[model samples]
Target: MNFTDIDPDKLFSSTDNSNPIMWLVWIVPIVVFMFYGQRIQLQITSGEISKNIAKLVKYKEESKKELLDYLQTNLKATPDAAKKIDGFLEYFTIMPVDFDPNGIIPKIKHLLRSREDYTRQQVKSLSPNMDALEVSKVQNLLEVTTSLHLLHKLVRHLFLTAKKQNNFPLILPLQMMIPFIMEQASALRDAVSALKQGQPIGDGIGPMVVGKMMLGTEKKTITFETVCAEKEFEQRKLYLLKAEGPTATVGRPGDAVELLVLKNKPDIIVMIDAALKLEGEDSGSVAQGFGAAIGGIGTDRFQIEEIATKNNIPIYAVVIKQSVKEAITLMTKQISDKAESVESQVFQIILENTKPNQSALIVGVGNTLGVPQ
Candidate 1:
């Protein structure tokens, strides 16, 4: 023992073959304990998890109470607002299946029924004197809703078919990232709920995603230095205008987009911007909607949208989803497995629909937040 007296050959040659399963027996319990411990730590550290769940519970209770209040108060629904809510809710409620399936339009159509009475009542509460023009806009919105419904249905059907055919791998790693996916979904659901309640959805997710750099308040002729950063938009008819704001803000809001559309008389407008998402989110979960005209929520998006609405121009928005850094790097592929498809959908809207007299304005909206102008 003192001087390596035991025979070296015997020690090296002899081996004990223990069951490999025995190692797991010792490891698994330790892993389970660690996992449970981490969950407890997470619960303590992230109050929002419990608070959000409580909020959901509170929302359900309030929704029930709202129904009761409507019945008791004889509150009427605002037709336009009701229509918007009903349409949004119809599509929002659908559970996503077949992670890669394309069904946005069909799904909306399937879920859309007659506008809820409560929704109509709420709309009336918000806007009592909604005009004929507003009514027409709501009708147009219904068409969009129908298309969304159809898209969802198509996605579901595609997924179902793929499942039957067994066309995909037996295991997809993307499915393993459920908790992250659920977090993003919950964030979206919460935002929508707040919207329905006319409440704020916080400065965390919404402002990071679709809300920024809103244009349009002063009405005048405007122009941008037309630079086609991406080839897909290059061939399409394009125009550019420059607007400088306070150090903290860049790109005009939605109201500006509307004013420009009316004054410049453009046929089509498109906004290209960087959209922020949670650290780990499904790349494909972009929730598109109407934007504001001036400095408000999603104002940048709204500016282009307002112009579209006012001048009867089609407004298409393409948002590159990334963290602030990734956005600067212009990484085409983000976390989603279907990044190509997402990019294609965005690019197609701008490129495929070009006509002889159409002018498209693509706004690269982001925080010129941290970048040098």
Candidate 2:
């Protein structure tokens, strides 16, 4: 009752083990956490990760199903055709040694070309009646399916390893990455539909602009799957280069650029493509800068840069901004509608940069899906 009357000995004494409330309040929690805390936390974390992994699996399976359906319904292929594609999904290529880093682009390009041929051949063999356009579509669709499959496999592998090792730290990175992984997988899933329909994607904005420019002009094949056409604007000769399309292919623009540079001795090289927008940047916004502006395996960019630099030509770039998702998925009305403005910008760049009798090379660098030469 009084400050000095308290029992000092009782305050420091051990708890009464006989009291159930004390055990429930302190001892029980201490014992549980000391022994099974990680197990409980693991179950909680694993449950969340497993839920996302299930979604990833669904996306992968759906893509695979779509491809099989396309094979049967469109190609009129046998059921074994689906099996062949399933086998193809696991195909991979080893990159050439980059230790020296010289002449690696050619080796990389060769390996990529071989892989592309193999992919096209596999799709072609199943349906000899399918045209080149059909083959390109099927090949693109197959790539989307294969990418989803690989993502699913990689995520599952991480999940299993974390579970097996009973290590929460090991799994934390996967947890952090699941959102990005799912974002990409969802985009890949959306792409399957566009590829199946042979619709243009945001990336096609580049080609769409140039394709419109090349329309009603005399066109010639400059390289594999690439075409070039010439036009006169003001007093300058504009040589338009783009992937030959209405098919899902980004042709060898590098070779096309090299050939054109040597042939015409263009005063400037301008490359246009769809670029990824920053977090706050408006989609479909047009931006211009100086560079090759090509987005791919970098071989094209290298070639474009090399030839432009060697010829003492200034390289200019005009880009339409969009997200990776938008670039690969269906061409949004916003992007498709922006092509006209982009074309105007290209013409302006040519007019302001070059003079009479000077030739300008313009490259529409992207997957020219649904955009014809």
Identify the runs in model 1 with alpha carbons over 4 angstroms from their true place: 1-237, 241-248, 278-304, 323-348, 369-373
**Candidates' lDDT values, in order?**
0.39, 0.89
**Per-residue lDDT over 1-373 for candidate 2, one digit per residue giving the tens place of the 0 to 100 score:** 7889866555544555575655576788999999998888888989998998899889989998998888888888765797798799889889888899989999998898889888888898877569989999988988898999899899999999999999888888998998889988889999998899999988999888899999899999888999999999898889999999988899999899999999889999888899999889999999999988988779888988898889999999999999889999999999988988998888888888988988998899888888887
lDDT of 1 at 28: 70
lDDT of 1 by residue, 1-373 (tens): 5657866544443342354454465667788877675454443434433343354444434443343343234434344544455444354344336466566433433343223334334433444554423322233223223333443344345434534554433212322333453344334333322222222212212122222222222223243211121121354544443332211133333444555566567556655444665769644355343332122233245345544776677666554455433332222333323334434554556556675555565444432222221
RMSD versus native structure for model 1: 15.2
TM-score of 2: 0.90
Per-prediction count of colliding residue pairs?
53, 0
